[model samples]
Target: MILRSPYPDVEIPEVPLPEFLFGAGFGDRGDAAAFIDGATGSSVTFDELTGMVTRIAAALHERGLRRGDVVALFAPNSPAWVAVFQGVLRANGIVTSANSLYSPAELAHQLTDSGATMLVTVSPFLDRATAAAAQAGLPDDAVVTLDPVDGRTSLVDLLGSSATPPELEVGPGDTAVLPYSSGTTGLAKGVVLTHRNLVANLLQFTPLGTTDETTRILAVLPFFHIYGMTVMMNHGLHRRATVVTMPRFDMAEFLRVVAEYRLNRLYIAPPVAVALAKHPLVDEHDLSCVDVIFSGAAPLDAELGHAVARRLGCVVLQGYGMTELSPVSHSMDERHPDDDLNGVGYAIPNVESKLVDPETGREVGPGERGELWVRGPNVMSGYLNNPSATAATLDADGFLHTGDVATVDERGFFRIVDRVKELIKYKGYQVPPAELEAVLLTHPGIADAAVIGVSDAEGEEVPKAFVVVQEGVTLTADDVMAFVAERLAPYKKVRVVEFLDAIPKSASGKILRKDLRARENA
Candidate 1:
């Protein structure tokens, strides 16, 4: 029982991302501010942005970057990041964006695995970026910072190049960006997204009528994440909306930027909804400019969604996606203000979805819980260099098995109930239990470790570690937590630690996560 989107299918253009974005029908928007720096109030007009992209592309080309060559972008959300991103595309090169919070080791893993030829980062992150570059065998000259610094190649230097922009060497089917994801299990793998995958997604949501030239979007979420990359950055550009970039989330700064910029459209994760609903500082700002707050990347509590709507006098909505789906498969449109906020609204145009029982491999009808399988132009090509992982997720039928258990109504609205995947969502970031468990095993005092998602006091999912200390070794819960924290990103830190004599396992040696979950519930 395959469920098709309720909306009419949108026609996707067979153009490269750069051509789709910067090529045609943008003359009128040339004078409009394309992106603004939230803190500095600095901006670049559409014309200026295109010019920078041209210059950056020319510089990268002159510096020997070629088609299919990968460049790793390791930075936070900023207007400059957007330029460099599109710049790489314009240069006919691939980009693999790394999480801003990644430790040197984590960043190096991505750099080495992605086969990135060059690394782009900011001055503040030079320590980790340089260390990661060295570990990945990247030369010092390969490190290019967004901001100018002494003895470092900077974006300003790139923009100074007088060479002509290279011809479009990539087409719709060519790989454009490689964003890492811990799909169903195991370590992070690069999800191959093509130019068409991006362009199709941009067009697929056109019926939503959410943002346009009149919209002012607050981009507080990290642009490296797919939610921010597609929904906020590219979508905003496609619709000619002014996007304001925030380097990082600071409560006061976020509010000030929203109010100052008179931003009306906001795309956020569930955790931000918690702040918007209960944080007293939210009352301090005149957020009347905000008309919609759309949450994605994780589930939003219905009560929390309503609370935020009540507090902000705005419509609250939720969407669903995975990196393997080019990030968005279903989303609540602004037109459907009456739709239930809990269910991720109708499947976006051009998407066909199915709910299949994992055990039986049988398709489930409406109202039955099953693993979601989606097929669309926006679906990823596959995982980079891992055909087995790709085959396990995307079947021969073209359906990408999402591993998330969901149920659909007769009307085609889907609600996520549970997940078959071992991946944990910690504050909307992917915290793979396998990754954390592997890190924990490196601790000298730990003999064995198992990590699982547990609800914190705030009802947020956090990674909880159950450790079995080696004989004659002394270890505290704090010690276990600290060991994992030092090796991983901040969001991947083990919040709760419990010492266990032995981790329950099946005869096949698989960790009995269900038993650990039952223990947590008990």
Candidate 2:
């Protein structure tokens, strides 16, 4: 029983991503602000942004980057970062974004798996990027820094004299961005999003009343993540809105930017919502200018949502999607401000969804909890270089199994009930259990390990490890956590560790994560 979007479908363009974004139809909002650097108060207007994109595109093309070539971007949110992303697309090269906080090993895996020949990063990350590049077998010249440095080539040097964008045979089907995701299980694999998938999602989300020339969006979310890539960076620029970019989320700085810029919209994850609800710092600043807040990437508590809404006197809503869905399928329409805050809201335009019993593989009726399966123009083409995983995820009928357990109400609103996958969401970032277990096994003291998410006091899911230490080895929980912290991102570090005699496993040697979760609850 498939449920369709309540809204009417809109036309999605079939042009290449660059053409669709910077084409002639958009009127003279050219002088309007496109992106603002929150820290330095620097601004880039729409007209200037287009020129920078074209120049960078021309430079990349002149430097021998061609269509289908992969260029990796490893940086935090900034106006320059936006230019680099669009520039890569305009050059007909696929952009593979990496988390700026990634360790060398983690970054190397993505670079090798994505087949990225060139790496672009900022000065602060140069050491790690260089190490990762060497590990991935990339040449020294392939690592380009954002700023000019003594030994490395800077992006500025590549911005040659010409502002002409590269001419290439790009089609709607051509892959544009390769953001990595763990999907339902395993280590992260590159999600192959084509030009049409992203453009379609932009059009699908436009009717939600978040985009316009007059809009000022606070971009605290990382652009490397799909949720930020689509909703904040692409959508904001497409609408010619001013985006205030924050390199990192500092509660006081976030508030200061909002007050200073009079930012009217906020694109954020759930942990920020908790701060808005409980943190006294929220009261110290004037947030009356904010008219709406859209929270995504993880589930936001209904009561907490309401509390923040009341505190800020703004509309607070939640949305749901995965990287495979161009990161947005259902979002609360700002036009219908009275909709229930509990559900993630109705499907966006042109999206079709159904709830199915995971065991039976049969569609379930409305209000029944089942794994969500979505089919839409915004669904990704496949996982890069992993056809078997892609086949397992995308069915012959075209629905992409989300691995998220949800229920659709009679009115077609969807609420996530549970997750069927082992991917843990720590403040909306994917932390694969298998990846952590692999890291744990590398520790000499650890004989075996299984990882599962346990809800912290703040209601956020955090990775907790149950370890089987080698005999005669005295391994403290701090020692286990420190080992992971040295090799993984701060968010991916295990927060809790429990020493165990043995990790429960199936006869096939698969870690029984469900058993560990049950033990945590017990």
The candidate scoring highest on TM-score is 1
- The C-alpha TM-scores of every prediction are 0.83, 0.82
Q: Taking the tens digit of each residue's C-alpha lDDT, what string does model 2 give over 1-522?
A: 888899999898789878888987357788878899999999988888888888898888888899999999998889989999998898889999998778899899999999999999999999999999999999999999888888887878766546456685689999999999832255778999999999999999889775788899999988988988999999987887889999988899999999999999998776577567766689899999999998887666676678789999999988888899998999888888787776889999999999998879888988687899999999999999999989999999899998888888898988876667767889988786756775776676766677899999999999999998776789999999999999999999999999888776422123556678778779
lDDT of 1 by residue, 347-406 (tens): 999999999998799999998878999999999999999999889989999999988888
* lDDT for position 360 in model 1: 97
Query: What clash count goes with each model?
Result: 0, 0
Candidate 1 whole-model C-alpha lDDT, 0 to 1: 0.87
Which residue segments of model 2 deviate by more than 4 Å? 182-184, 422-522
